[model samples]
Target: MKVAVMGAGAVGCYFAGMLARVGHQVALVGRPQHVEAFNTRGLRLETKAFDETIAVKASTDAAIAADAELVLFCVKSPDTETAGAQLAPHLAPDTLVLSLQNGTDNAERLRTVMAQPVAAAVVYVATEMAGPGHVKHHGRGELVIEPAAGSRDAADALVAAGVPTEISDNVRGELWLKLILNCAYNALSAIAQLPYGKLVEGPGIPEVIAQLVTECKAVAAAEGVTLADDVDSAVRKIVQTMPGQFSSTAQDLARGKPSEIDHLNGFIVARAQAHGLSAPANLTVHALVKLIESKAQ
Candidate 1:
């Protein structure tokens, strides 16, 4: 299948490399640095299983998606509308656009700008761009996507390429689950500049995380999303599962790049406010992260 990865960041490059490894024609649309590197040296994928460069097409223009049958929209939350607009003029009528993004509502936002069918996927991959054209995968490469017209075939294709894929009727719930996890950790990690282990060791940190999780769950419930009963346990298990791993927000702050706190904790705060509630814990962390980002700038 011909595939196009819009916004070839870590997640985009990793999945594109996987498809390319399976001999799928893949084009990565990204920054000029990554595009140039991939065009010259191929995409370097450092996975838990192997480390190698995979040959793929690379371009900085969204027009590269014109001929693709499957398009993975992987832009960050802030770039969702802008990137969607850029791809709107070029999308094929039959193209399957899946939003492989962080926060929820991205697919809905895309549909507002484009006539293309858009599906949302809960991506459970831990990956980062080590360098230009190099994606380092820490662990877990699986996707839980919403069922749509072409989703079954897309899931099969992804599974055949070694990525575990599932079609779920409640993808919104899955997205909220991931969002709750992000709210529980991302901002705290960013504000402290600490990994899961050390971050959990601070005094009163557990209580703070509990408060965040409670507020996020209330917001999710108010929004009519059914989260898992063990969501709190899941949030706490991250410290044990990846003790040394820093949240993506932490990595972004350390790199002097903008973090996604606005969509994580800030999103909870916004939704809670709309529902006539407040999320003090999420609000505090979100504000602190914004302060740190402002200072960094």
Candidate 2:
């Protein structure tokens, strides 16, 4: 398959490198530095299994998507519309655009801007850009994508490339499950600039997380998405499972990049308001992160 990764950051690079290693034609559209680095030396994929450089085509222009049969739309939530528009005129009609992003609504947002088939995937991977064109994988690389036209083929192809992929009919519920987890940890971690373990050790922080999870669950229920019964336990388990890991929002704040708090906790707050419910915990943390972002600016 000829695959194009739209936002070729950490997640994009990891999957793109995997596909390229399997002999698929992969093109990465990302920052200039990443493009230059990949073109100079193949993308460095540092994983627990191995550290290898995988050859791939890299470019900054979104136009490269034109040649792709499958496009991995991996831009951040806020950039969804703009990035989709940039790729809209270039994508082939039969292109399968999978939104490999953090937020829940990115694929729907992309559909609004492009006529190509769009599908949402719940990504379960821990990766980061160690440097330009270098992706370091911590663990877990599996994807649960919504069933769509050609999605089965896409899933089969990805699984064959070493990324376990599944097509799920309940992808919306899966997305909300992940959203609830993010609402519980992301903003709080960002505001404290702490890793999960340290953040959970703070006074009354666990209670706050519980409340946030409860609020998100209420919103999800009101929106008619049935979240898992073990959702609360899942949120609490993150500290134990990935104790040293900082939330992505924390990493973004530390790097002076805009965090995705708006789409995480902020989305919950908005949905709560629409449903005539109050999400006090989520609202408070969302405001704090917004304030921190404002001060940083």
Candidate 3:
């Protein structure tokens, strides 16, 4: 299959590289630096398994998606509308677009902007741009995508390309589950410039994390999304498992790039307000990120 990845950041490059490794034609649309490196040599993928450079198509132009049968919408939440619009005028009639992103509303937001079927996919992976045209995978590469009209076929294709994917009926709930994890740690860790291990080792850290989890569960329940099993356990486990990890938001702030706080905690806070509920924890995190954003300016 011919695939086009809309945002060639860590997530986009990782999956696109996987597909290209399997002999599929994949093009990555991303920053000029990455694209130029890819065009000159090849896309470098560093993983726990091995480090290899895979040859693939790379472009800085979004219109390169015009002929693609599958388009992985991997841009950050803040760039969703603009990226969606850039691809909207050019996508093929039967193109399958999947929003492989962090926030919950990316798929719906894309649908409003594009006439094609956009599926929401929950991604569980830790990856980063180790260098120009280089994507490094830390762990966990699995996908739970919304049950869209073309989702089953898309999932099959993804699985064949070595990406574990499932077409799920409850992708929205899964998104919320991931959001809770972010709400509990992303801001706190970012502000402290600490990883999960050190973040949870501080005085009163457990109590603070507990409060955030409780507030997130309440907001999710109010919005009719089934809260994850043992929210506390999930949030706690991420620290034990990926103690050295910095959230994409944290990385963004550190690099002076724009963070996606407004879509993560801010989205939860907005939904809570809509349902006559207050999400103090989420609101607090959102405000802190905004403050950091101001300081970065």
Models 1 onward score TM values of: 0.96, 0.95, 0.95
Per-residue error for 265 in candidate 1, Å, reads 0.6
Instruction: Give the per-residue lDDT digits (tens) of candidate 2, residues 30-114.
Output: 9998999999998999988999998888889998777798888898899999999999899888789999888789888999999
Candidate 1 wrongly placed segments (more than 4 Å): none
Better of 1 and 3 by lDDT: 1
Report the lDDT tens digits of candidate 3 across residue range 1-297. 888999999998998988888888888899999999999889998888879899988888888777888898999898899989988888876788999988778888999889888888888778889889999998778888888767888788889988999877778788889888888888887777787788889998878888878877888888788753567777867887777777888888888888888887888788889988888877887898889989878
- lDDT by residue for model 1 over 219-297, one digit each (tens)? 9889999874379778877776667767889988998889888889999999999999999999999999998899888
Query: What TM-score should be assigned to candidate 1?
Result: 0.96
Worst 10 residues of 1 by lDDT: 228-237
Which residue pairs in candidate 2 collide? none
Model 2 weakest lDDT span, ten residues long: 228-237
Tell how far residue 172 is off in model 3, in angstroms.
Answer: 1.4
> Which 10-residue window of candidate 3 scores lowest in summed lDDT?
227-236
